[model samples]
Target: MIVQVALATGFVLILIGIYGALTQRNLLRMIVAFTVANSGVNLVIVAVGYLPGRTAPILDATVPAAEAAARIIDPVPQALVLTAIVIGLGVTALMLAFAYKLYEKRRSLDIARFSELKW
Candidate 1:
Protein backbone atom coordinates (compact mmCIF):
# COMPACT_ATOMS: atom_id res chain seq x y z
CA MET A 1 0.00 0.00 0.00
CA ILE A 2 2.77 2.40 0.88
CA VAL A 3 4.65 1.65 -2.30
CA GLN A 4 1.54 2.11 -4.39
CA VAL A 5 0.87 5.45 -2.81
CA ALA A 6 4.45 6.54 -3.37
CA LEU A 7 4.26 5.60 -7.03
CA ALA A 8 0.99 7.44 -7.50
CA THR A 9 2.27 10.53 -5.76
CA GLY A 10 5.44 10.49 -7.84
CA PHE A 11 3.45 10.29 -11.06
CA VAL A 12 1.29 13.21 -9.98
CA LEU A 13 4.37 15.30 -9.25
CA ILE A 14 5.77 14.45 -12.69
CA LEU A 15 2.56 15.51 -14.35
CA ILE A 16 2.51 18.78 -12.50
CA GLY A 17 6.10 19.46 -13.43
CA ILE A 18 5.39 18.76 -17.08
CA TYR A 19 2.44 21.09 -17.09
CA GLY A 20 4.41 23.83 -15.37
CA ALA A 21 7.35 23.45 -17.72
CA LEU A 22 5.09 23.68 -20.77
CA THR A 23 2.96 26.63 -19.66
CA GLN A 24 5.32 28.80 -17.63
CA ARG A 25 7.48 31.52 -19.19
CA ASN A 26 10.19 32.21 -16.61
CA LEU A 27 13.40 30.26 -17.37
CA LEU A 28 14.26 29.60 -13.72
CA ARG A 29 10.77 28.34 -12.95
CA MET A 30 10.98 25.97 -15.87
CA ILE A 31 14.25 24.62 -14.53
CA VAL A 32 12.66 24.16 -11.12
CA ALA A 33 9.78 22.28 -12.69
CA PHE A 34 12.22 20.02 -14.48
CA THR A 35 13.89 19.34 -11.15
CA VAL A 36 10.55 18.38 -9.67
CA ALA A 37 9.93 15.91 -12.49
CA ASN A 38 13.32 14.39 -11.96
CA SER A 39 12.63 13.99 -8.24
CA GLY A 40 9.37 12.21 -8.96
CA VAL A 41 11.12 9.70 -11.15
CA ASN A 42 13.81 9.12 -8.55
CA LEU A 43 11.25 8.57 -5.84
CA VAL A 44 9.44 5.99 -7.94
CA ILE A 45 12.67 4.16 -8.60
CA VAL A 46 13.56 4.09 -4.90
CA ALA A 47 10.09 2.94 -3.93
CA VAL A 48 10.34 0.03 -6.35
CA GLY A 49 13.33 -1.32 -4.47
CA TYR A 50 11.40 -1.54 -1.23
CA LEU A 51 10.48 -5.02 0.03
CA PRO A 52 7.63 -5.47 2.48
CA GLY A 53 8.85 -8.64 4.25
CA ARG A 54 12.50 -7.93 4.08
CA THR A 55 15.05 -6.59 6.52
CA ALA A 56 17.52 -3.82 6.00
CA PRO A 57 20.58 -4.64 3.91
CA ILE A 58 22.98 -3.91 6.71
CA LEU A 59 25.24 -6.97 7.04
CA ASP A 60 25.32 -7.34 10.80
CA ALA A 61 25.64 -10.96 11.94
CA THR A 62 22.73 -10.42 14.35
CA VAL A 63 20.29 -10.34 11.40
CA PRO A 64 18.27 -13.56 11.10
CA ALA A 65 19.43 -15.84 8.30
CA ALA A 66 16.04 -16.06 6.57
CA GLU A 67 15.60 -12.33 6.33
CA ALA A 68 19.07 -11.94 4.95
CA ALA A 69 18.34 -14.53 2.26
CA ALA A 70 15.48 -12.46 0.88
CA ARG A 71 16.72 -10.79 -2.25
CA ILE A 72 18.25 -7.47 -1.32
CA ILE A 73 17.27 -4.29 -3.06
CA ASP A 74 19.36 -3.79 -6.19
CA PRO A 75 22.14 -1.36 -5.35
CA VAL A 76 22.77 -0.42 -8.96
CA PRO A 77 19.71 1.76 -9.27
CA GLN A 78 20.63 3.63 -6.09
CA ALA A 79 24.15 4.19 -7.38
CA LEU A 80 22.80 5.38 -10.70
CA VAL A 81 20.56 7.84 -8.90
CA LEU A 82 23.56 9.22 -7.03
CA THR A 83 25.36 9.79 -10.34
CA ALA A 84 22.23 11.33 -11.79
CA ILE A 85 22.02 13.72 -8.86
CA VAL A 86 25.54 14.94 -9.56
CA ILE A 87 24.72 15.32 -13.23
CA GLY A 88 21.53 17.17 -12.34
CA LEU A 89 23.55 19.64 -10.30
CA GLY A 90 25.62 20.36 -13.37
CA VAL A 91 22.52 20.76 -15.51
CA THR A 92 21.01 23.19 -13.00
CA ALA A 93 24.20 25.23 -12.96
CA LEU A 94 24.25 25.44 -16.73
CA MET A 95 20.58 26.38 -16.86
CA LEU A 96 21.14 29.08 -14.26
CA ALA A 97 24.01 30.47 -16.29
CA PHE A 98 21.83 30.66 -19.39
CA ALA A 99 19.09 32.33 -17.37
CA TYR A 100 21.55 34.91 -16.11
CA LYS A 101 22.72 35.60 -19.64
CA LEU A 102 19.15 35.96 -20.78
CA TYR A 103 18.55 38.47 -18.04
CA GLU A 104 21.67 40.40 -19.01
CA LYS A 105 20.76 40.45 -22.71
CA ARG A 106 17.23 41.79 -22.20
CA ARG A 107 17.22 43.15 -18.65
CA SER A 108 14.16 40.94 -18.07
CA LEU A 109 13.30 37.36 -17.12
CA ASP A 110 10.26 36.97 -19.34
CA ILE A 111 10.61 34.17 -21.92
CA ALA A 112 8.08 35.63 -24.35
CA ARG A 113 10.32 38.60 -25.05
CA PHE A 114 13.21 36.43 -26.29
CA SER A 115 11.39 34.66 -29.12
CA GLU A 116 13.83 35.99 -31.66
CA LEU A 117 17.18 34.22 -32.07
CA LYS A 118 19.21 37.35 -32.87
CA TRP A 119 18.25 39.34 -29.78
Candidate 2:
Protein backbone atom coordinates (compact mmCIF):
# COMPACT_ATOMS: atom_id res chain seq x y z
CA MET A 1 0.00 0.00 0.00
CA ILE A 2 2.65 2.49 1.13
CA VAL A 3 5.02 1.36 -1.59
CA GLN A 4 2.50 2.12 -4.28
CA VAL A 5 1.89 5.53 -2.79
CA ALA A 6 5.59 6.30 -2.74
CA LEU A 7 6.03 5.16 -6.31
CA ALA A 8 3.12 7.31 -7.43
CA THR A 9 4.42 10.33 -5.54
CA GLY A 10 7.84 9.87 -7.07
CA PHE A 11 6.39 9.74 -10.56
CA VAL A 12 4.35 12.87 -9.89
CA LEU A 13 7.42 14.69 -8.66
CA ILE A 14 9.35 13.65 -11.75
CA LEU A 15 6.62 15.01 -14.00
CA ILE A 16 6.42 18.27 -12.09
CA GLY A 17 10.18 18.68 -12.22
CA ILE A 18 10.32 18.05 -15.93
CA TYR A 19 7.49 20.53 -16.51
CA GLY A 20 9.18 23.17 -14.37
CA ALA A 21 12.46 22.68 -16.15
CA LEU A 22 10.84 23.03 -19.54
CA THR A 23 8.69 26.07 -18.71
CA GLN A 24 11.05 28.11 -16.50
CA ARG A 25 13.52 30.45 -18.14
CA ASN A 26 15.70 31.27 -15.18
CA LEU A 27 18.91 29.27 -14.79
CA LEU A 28 18.35 28.80 -11.08
CA ARG A 29 14.85 27.53 -11.60
CA MET A 30 16.05 25.02 -14.15
CA ILE A 31 18.71 23.77 -11.76
CA VAL A 32 16.12 23.41 -9.03
CA ALA A 33 13.86 21.50 -11.36
CA PHE A 34 16.68 19.15 -12.32
CA THR A 35 17.42 18.56 -8.68
CA VAL A 36 13.80 17.78 -7.98
CA ALA A 37 13.75 15.34 -10.85
CA ASN A 38 16.91 13.67 -9.60
CA SER A 39 15.33 13.28 -6.17
CA GLY A 40 12.27 11.75 -7.72
CA VAL A 41 14.39 9.26 -9.61
CA ASN A 42 16.19 8.31 -6.45
CA LEU A 43 12.93 7.92 -4.57
CA VAL A 44 11.46 5.75 -7.29
CA ILE A 45 14.54 3.52 -7.34
CA VAL A 46 14.44 3.10 -3.58
CA ALA A 47 10.74 2.41 -3.55
CA VAL A 48 11.11 -0.20 -6.23
CA GLY A 49 13.89 -1.94 -4.35
CA TYR A 50 12.02 -1.94 -1.05
CA LEU A 51 10.55 -5.18 0.25
CA PRO A 52 7.75 -4.91 2.73
CA GLY A 53 8.34 -6.54 6.12
CA ARG A 54 11.86 -7.51 5.17
CA THR A 55 15.05 -6.77 7.02
CA ALA A 56 18.31 -5.40 5.79
CA PRO A 57 20.66 -7.69 3.86
CA ILE A 58 22.53 -8.80 6.89
CA LEU A 59 22.80 -12.13 8.58
CA ASP A 60 22.52 -12.39 12.34
CA ALA A 61 20.93 -14.52 15.00
CA THR A 62 17.46 -13.43 13.87
CA VAL A 63 18.15 -14.60 10.33
CA PRO A 64 20.17 -17.68 9.56
CA ALA A 65 22.58 -17.74 6.64
CA ALA A 66 20.51 -20.32 4.82
CA GLU A 67 17.37 -18.16 4.93
CA ALA A 68 19.16 -14.82 4.57
CA ALA A 69 18.20 -14.50 0.93
CA ALA A 70 14.54 -14.82 1.71
CA ARG A 71 14.58 -12.52 4.71
CA ILE A 72 16.79 -9.69 3.44
CA ILE A 73 15.96 -6.89 1.10
CA ASP A 74 17.96 -6.37 -2.07
CA PRO A 75 20.87 -3.98 -1.59
CA VAL A 76 21.73 -3.14 -5.17
CA PRO A 77 19.11 -0.44 -5.57
CA GLN A 78 20.08 1.18 -2.29
CA ALA A 79 23.72 1.29 -3.31
CA LEU A 80 22.86 2.61 -6.74
CA VAL A 81 20.68 5.32 -5.28
CA LEU A 82 23.42 6.35 -2.87
CA THR A 83 25.90 6.65 -5.70
CA ALA A 84 23.39 8.53 -7.81
CA ILE A 85 22.75 10.97 -4.95
CA VAL A 86 26.43 11.77 -4.63
CA ILE A 87 26.83 12.20 -8.36
CA GLY A 88 23.70 14.35 -8.52
CA LEU A 89 24.99 16.61 -5.76
CA GLY A 90 28.25 17.12 -7.59
CA VAL A 91 26.43 17.84 -10.84
CA THR A 92 24.10 20.28 -9.14
CA ALA A 93 27.05 22.09 -7.58
CA LEU A 94 28.75 22.33 -10.96
CA MET A 95 25.56 23.65 -12.56
CA LEU A 96 25.17 26.24 -9.82
CA ALA A 97 28.74 27.37 -10.26
CA PHE A 98 28.29 27.73 -13.98
CA ALA A 99 25.05 29.63 -13.46
CA TYR A 100 26.75 31.93 -10.99
CA LYS A 101 29.52 32.64 -13.48
CA LEU A 102 26.99 33.39 -16.20
CA TYR A 103 25.03 35.59 -13.84
CA GLU A 104 28.15 37.46 -12.88
CA LYS A 105 29.05 38.04 -16.51
CA ARG A 106 25.60 39.19 -17.66
CA ARG A 107 23.98 40.33 -14.41
CA SER A 108 21.00 38.14 -15.30
CA LEU A 109 19.96 34.50 -14.86
CA ASP A 110 17.45 34.42 -17.68
CA ILE A 111 18.17 31.79 -20.34
CA ALA A 112 17.33 34.17 -23.16
CA ARG A 113 19.96 36.65 -22.02
CA PHE A 114 22.83 34.37 -23.02
CA SER A 115 22.53 33.50 -26.66
CA GLU A 116 26.15 33.67 -27.71
CA LEU A 117 26.11 30.09 -29.01
CA LYS A 118 22.83 30.46 -30.90
CA TRP A 119 23.31 30.49 -34.63
Candidate RMSDs in order: 2.7, 1.6
The TM-score that candidate 1 achieves is 0.84
Angstrom error of the Cα, residue 83, model 1: value is 1.4
Model 1 clash pairs? none
lDDT of 2 at 117: 98
Q: Model 1: per-residue lDDT, tens digit, 1-119? A: 88799989989989999999999988889999999998888888877877766645666776655766664555666777778888988988999999999899999888898888845
List lDDT for all candidates, in order.
0.82, 0.94
Can you list the residue pairs that collide in candidate 2? none
| Local accuracy of candidate 2 as per-residue lDDT tens digits, 2-61 | 789999999999999999999999999999999999999999999999899998877889
TM-score for candidate 2, please give it.
0.90
Candidate 1: which stretches are off by over 4 Å? 62-67, 117-119
